[model samples]
Each structure stands twice: as C-alpha cells, then as structure tokens.
Target: MHEQESTRLGDEIVRLVRMGARFRGMFKTGDLGAEFSALMLLPPLRAMGPMRVTDLAEFKQADPSTVSRQAAQLVKAGLARREADPADGRASRLAVTEAGVQACERVREARAAMLERALADWPAERITAFTDLFEEFNHAVEALLRTDPTTPPREPA
Candidate 1:
C-alpha cells in the first residue's frame, strides 16, 4: 500500500472517531432519553421545503405510514402542519410552522453550544475550516448518492 494512501485513510478514521465522540457528548447533555426522533426530523424538514407525506417517507427511506404517523405527531405538537398541495388536490404537504421554526432554532442553538464546548480549545480558523470541509463532504456524498443509489463512494470495503 502507498504511504500517502495510508495516511489519508488514517486521517479519515480520526475525523470519524472525533465526530462520533462529539455526537455522544451532545446526546449526553439532553437527558431526553435515547429517543430523539423529533430532533432528527427537525433538520430534514429544515433542509427540504414542504413535501407531501409520501415524499417525506421517500426522503427518510421510511414507510409511508411511519412518516405519516410521525408527521401527524409533529402537527399535533404544533411543530408542523398539513397544507393543501396546489399540484394535487387530494394530497397534502407537511411543512414546519412558525412555532416549528422557533423550536428548530432552539434545538440548533443547543447543539451549537455543545459543539462550542467540545471545541473550545481549537482555534477559530481550524473550526471554520472543519465546517467548510464537512459541508463540502456532505455535498459530495449527496451528489454521489443521487447519481447512483446502488453504490456510494464512501462505503466500507
């Protein structure tokens, strides 16, 4: 094996290890038990605009009924709502409400606080670079998956 290839793989391993540790620390802070389905739903809803329940199921790689149930819970909690879809009269799209947006912001702020505490000793430049690189990686992976779902470039050998 090439020495350079070995070093690159080692760097990626280190990054993954650090990321897992940071996520563990964040979860430890919110005694919200082991279930954080609400938190998980928040980011995806924030990223994707209003979508039909079926669409949400597809995006989440989940069953339609599960997605519908979760989305219904979100609506009942006032975090999300069902709106008539203009394109399809018989269907509805689930969208986060104003209150939902506020809730999302709060959750994000708390997570950011956790991250800040974890990386307090790191230089600002290093943190910024890490964020940039992570987003770039996310984009690359998203593109790869969209192009071919059968195989992603980052899968383990």
Candidate 2:
C-alpha cells in the first residue's frame, strides 16, 4: 500500500475501535449489569473449558492479578465457578456456569441487534462483503502479531 493509503486505513481502524468501545460502554450501562472487564473473561472460559487463572492470563495477554480479580467478580455474580483441577489436585480452575452461557448468548444477541440496526439500510451484498473482509483483516492482524518478534506487545482494547 502507498504511505497515504496506509495512513488512512490506520486512522479508520482507530476510529472503528473507538466507536466499538463507546458501544460497549453503552451496552454495559444499559442492560448488562456486569462490568465489561469481568464479562470478557466468560468467552475464554467458555471456549477453552476450565482453566487456571495463570493460564487464562497468558491466553489473554493480561496480568494474572487482573484475571484473578475478574474471575472473582464472575464467581461472585454466579457466572463462573471454581473446580478442582484434575491435572493438579492442589490447584483449582475456573469454569463457566450455565448462567454464564446464557449471559454470553444475551451479549451476542444484543451486539447482533445493534449491528443490524446500524446497517439496516445497507445492501445485503455489501454487508456480506464487508463481513468477509473484516474477518480476513482480523485474522491477518492476529497472524502478524503471532509471528512478528519485533512487534511490541500492547494492551488489549
């Protein structure tokens, strides 16, 4: 890409990220009583099954203490539970509860509804093409971060 085109794309990406954060804040304050940070832990636990806090921290690229605190909130909210780790009887792992699964479903529905409303006027073909390209872009970014040793680690959005 030309320097000008690259700069424009980068600016657009940043704007998109800011808009997403604003949307998340609105959702967090509207119907999802849980803190966004704590809610974020659910997807990983759901996807990976039970995992130790340390493992989750590594997977999220966050500090273990932050993950532990989030896990505590989730536990207190009855969204997640602690279970004995079969691999290490002395340690415990966190697992998402049925309620947590339901919460995840609700979040997914809300996000979809928001997107549908926002794009209601867009042509179906355009929406489909955008979705495909967006997924590809995200995958490219993840691959770059994974393979590039010189890339600096940054906090998750």
Candidate 3:
C-alpha cells in the first residue's frame, strides 16, 4: 500500500474504534439490571467456560485484583458463579450462569438490531463483502498479535 493509503487506513480504523467505544455505553438500558462494567465480564466467562481471576486477568492483560472484583460483582449479580477448580481445591473458577447467558443473548440482539438499522441502506452484496473483509482483517490482526513481540492480545471483537 502507498504511504498515504496506509495512513488513511490507520486513521479510519482509529475513528471506528472511537465510535465503537461510544456505542458500548449506549447499550446500557438495564436489560440485565446489573452494573454494565461487571456485565462486561460475562462474554469472556461464557466463552472460556470456567476460569480463575488470575487467568481472566492474564487473558485480558488487566490487573488480577481488578478482575477479581469484577468477577465478584458478577457473582453478586447472579450472572456468574464460583466453581471449585478440580486441579486446585483452594482456588475457584468463574463460570457464567444461565441468567448470564440470557443477558448475553439480549445484549447481542440489541447490538445486532442497531447494526442492522445502521446498515439498512447498504446493498446486500456490499454487506456480504464487508463481512468477509472484516473477518479477514480481524484474523490478520490476531495473527499479528500472536507473532509480533510488541503486539498484545486483545479481547475478541
């Protein structure tokens, strides 16, 4: 890619990221009646099965204590529960509860509805092409994160 094209691409990506951050806050409509920040832990716990706070922190590249507190909130909200780790009786793993799964689905539905409306004017072919390209882009980014010494693992999109 030309230098100018590369710069433009970077700028556009940054703009989209900022917009995504904004959209993140817009979904907090009390669908789950829990703190939005705490609920942020649901998806990972759901996807990862059961995990320790330390493991969650490592995967998120965040502080262990912070993740522990967040997980505690999830437990308090009944979104997640603590399960005894079979390998370590002293340690507990966090697992998403049925309520958490339902909440996750509701949130996803809202997000998908919003995205559908946002792209309502786009042609079907354009949408299909964008989906394919976006998936490829995300895979390339994940590959770079795995191989690049300076790149860090991030939560999936």
Candidate 4:
C-alpha cells in the first residue's frame, strides 16, 4: 500500500479501537452490570450452540486457561452451563443458557440501536456498502491473525 493510504488505515483502526473501549466501559458500568470480558463469550456460545473451552479458545485466538476462567465466571453468573460432551466421556461443552441468550440479545439490540442513531443521516445504500466492506475487513483481519506474516513491519506511530 502507498504510505499515505497505510497511515490513514492505521489511524482509522486506532480510532475504532478507542471507540470500542469507550463503548465497552459504558455498557459495563451501566444498568447491564456485566463486565465486557465475560459478556464477550455469550455471542459465540449463542451462535455455536455449545463449545469446549479449547474450541472457544481457538475460535477467539485466546489462551485456553483464560477462556476456562471466563467460562467459569459465565457459569457462576448463570449465563452459561457446562455439560458433559456425550460423544466424549471426559470432556465438556459450555452452552449459553436462556438468560445468556436474553442478555446477548439485549446487548446486541442496544448496540444496533446506538449505531443506527449514529448513522441516521447516512443513506441506506451507504450504510449497506459500509456494512459489507466492514465484514470483509473483519474476515481479512481474522485471516491475518491466523497466518504467519500477513503484513510488513509497522512504521512507528
């Protein structure tokens, strides 16, 4: 990429990261009363039905031990349940409970509503195009995270 293009992308990425941190803090401290770290597990569990800690860890690119602790917290909060994997006598899968699903839905709706308000001035076509591009960008990021040497060394900020 050209230097100017790369710099603009880096700046945009940093801004997005900062905005995400702000939103996370807002949700964690508000009426929801759930920590962002723990709430993060709900979406994957909701989507995947049930998953082992190792499976979640891989999917999240997180450490197994960390995911284990998060899973324990989720279970303790009654948001998730651990059940023996019938196919594997010794292993277990963590599944989101009804409460977990509701919580996830509430959070998702809140996020969507907020974004809708933020983008209310934009035309429908622009919003659709942005969504499509953002999804593609996220998949590119995931691929980069999974592989070796996806990009050149970063220039100092």
Which predicted model would earn the best lDDT? Answer: 2
lDDT winner, 1 or 3: 3
lDDT of model 3, residue 70: 80
- TM-score per prediction, in order, is 0.68, 0.87, 0.83, 0.86
Cα lDDT of model 2 by residue, 16-40, tens digit: 8789777875552344445777788
**Every candidate's lDDT:** 0.71, 0.84, 0.81, 0.80
Output the better candidate (2/3) by TM-score: 2
RMSD of candidate 4 to true structure, Å: 4.2
- Of candidate 4, the 10-residue stretch with the lowest lDDT total is 25-34
Residue lDDT tens for model 3, 1-157: 8999989999999998789767866764465757666677778888888998888887766677778788888788888899999999999999999998988877877788778888999999999999999999988976787789987544432
Local accuracy of candidate 1 as per-residue lDDT tens digits, 1-157: 5999979977997897788645745643343321245445656787887888777776766667767777777787787888899999888898888777776776677778878887999999999999998899778766777788686333210
Winner of 2 and 3 under lDDT: 2
Tell me, by TM-score, which candidate is best.
2
Clashes of each: 0, 0, 0, 0
Cα lDDT of model 4 by residue, 41-126, tens digit: 89989998899988988777777787888888888878899999988979999999898888888788777877887899999999
Clashing pairs in 3: none
Angstrom error of the Cα, residue 14, model 3: value is 1.4
Alpha-carbon shift of residue 12 in model 2 (angstroms): 1.0
Ordering by lDDT: 2, 3, 4, 1
